[model samples]
Target: MFEFAWPWAFALLPLPWLIALIAGKQKHHSTLMLRIHALAHMGMTNTKVTPSRKWPHWLLAIVWALVVASAANPVFRGEPITLSEPGRDIMLAVDLSGSMREQDMAYQGRFVDRLSVVKAVLSEFISQRRGDQLGLILFADTAFLQTPLTRDVDTVAQMLEESQIGLVGRATAIGDALGLSVKRFNEKSQSNKVVILLTDGQNTAGNLKPEEALILAKDAGVKVYTVGVGADGRNQGGLFSMLGSSGAMLDESLLKTIAEQTGGQYFRATDTQSLANIYKELDALEPQAEQEQTFRPVDALFYLPLSGALLMLFLAALWRQLKQQAVVGDA
Candidate 1:
């Protein structure tokens, strides 16, 4: 549909006519008629004052009308769009403690760090989450929100990929991570609020205890799915493998408790495949509706009329200048 953004501008369409009417009245009142004998005595010919050409005045009126039309801001609106309500608000809390550097997880038959495997799998998971608000939280000695709950999954994925071990600190703050997730969920009024926490070790730092965080999560009605990521074998032999070495220390009891307390499930991911499978299960549990959304596309048309008006004015001015030059040359 085509319409004017400021239709009120059309009210000024009579402005030129009003100005002409007032100017005519002023001219009539200011008129000074002299007798023909007085003019002959002054050696003046009986010359009549010829009225100015009306074409220029008419052209000016047209230009003014065009200018007013442009000022009305004409636009072409496509169609109205309706958007469906979002499915879920999922917050991802990943462990960035020093232990996450352990390389027990396999990717493409090659050993990779725990964090790398998480990033690769999580990126795919994020891509699949259409119409869901996703958030990212990185935790080490403390927890902090990397990205707020948003529908921009690509941004959350980028932030996850950019995260490095020990970015916050070397110790795991599981309680703080859960607490922060719960706090964030409370801020939104979404019906389905979820938190997926991936960590490799027990909580060694933070103000709140894991149990206390679980209480808050329950109160907020936020579901928390916890994943304990590491290799199973006690004697795994990778150059960076900390599983058989001193780095393997997962608090499965606490993780399972948090998940169960919040009416969520606990998953153990020993390799990249398992982690991917865990996220797949999550997708099944919280399936997104196939419904669609719509919105109108608008294109501004003010420039069209505005440009036409400017061009007409320029041509009118050029014509007047040329006519004046011709008169002067003839004289």
Candidate 2:
């Protein structure tokens, strides 16, 4: 409803009039000084003000009222709107090593590369995450932050879909991925920080080691969920189980250690069905708040009265100038 933001400002409504009354007792003799609050005084500012030419006392009072009303901060408060903030921050670190080129995962009854399946699944996953800050990391020979933490899940999904296998290098860098995630999480975290690390091979490249990254994440209170993606029957031109999980066999033990130490879980996605289940589990992560928040929108209306006051002042000045010119002509 329409109201004054600061109702106490109305107390100043009589301030200008009080000043007028007090000044009425003063007596001064000066031929040059203007004796009233009129725009005419602007031309003879140095003159001592005295009881002289009749001023528009009523106009001045109306102007003062308008100015006082503007200062009171009139506003129209809108209805309260409930905001459903997700409140959680998530980082998805995907392996883009040469091994990810393996055609182990089946899509639409046809074999596709590991990265393709990841892009499809994760893009859908990213779309459902509303109000949560999501980030993307692509790792191969090393780790790289593809997208910083943001609420724009559509952009995050676009980045994920645009990724190509072996874009960085051909070797997996699990430690570098985890370490990079930790650094990002520390940079901007409001609530919980979660890392979903997906890889089809063991950590064979990178400066940092898996054990070292694990300690770093645990110390920073960063939770990690490790996903090992390679088919059990990796032979017959699939992916793993034949060449032993692209470049090297899946390091289940290291993945498990990292997850457990960081207070997370380890999931093996040998197929698309299992990966979907993993998504369900990830969805269970705690949000920033259990209850929604609400806030009222306000629109300031002070400008309305403020504009009127300025216009009245301008007109008064113009009127005083006109009267002064008429008097000079008459003289």
* Separate clash counts for every candidate: 1, 4
In order, the Cα lDDT scores of the candidates are 0.85, 0.83
Q: lDDT tens digits, residues 154-261, model 1? A: 999999999999799988899999999989888876558889999888889999999899889999898999999888544356543433322366888899999998
Checking candidate 2 for backbone clashes, the offending pairs are 33-47, 35-50, 98-170, 234-240
Best-fitting candidate, measured by lDDT?
A: 1
lDDT by residue for model 2 (1-331), tens: 8999998999998888788678755734332254343546555686543334655788878888898899999999999999877667889999988778788778879878878888888888888888888999999999999999999999999999888876888888999999999999888645588899999889899989999998899989999999998775544575343556552388989999998888899999867777888888888754445568899999999999989989998988888888878777776
Q: Which stretches of candidate 2 lie over 4 Å from their true place?
A: 28-53, 188-190, 238-248, 285-288, 316-331
TM-score for each predicted model, relative to the true structure = 0.78, 0.84
RMSD, every candidate, angstroms: 4.2, 5.6
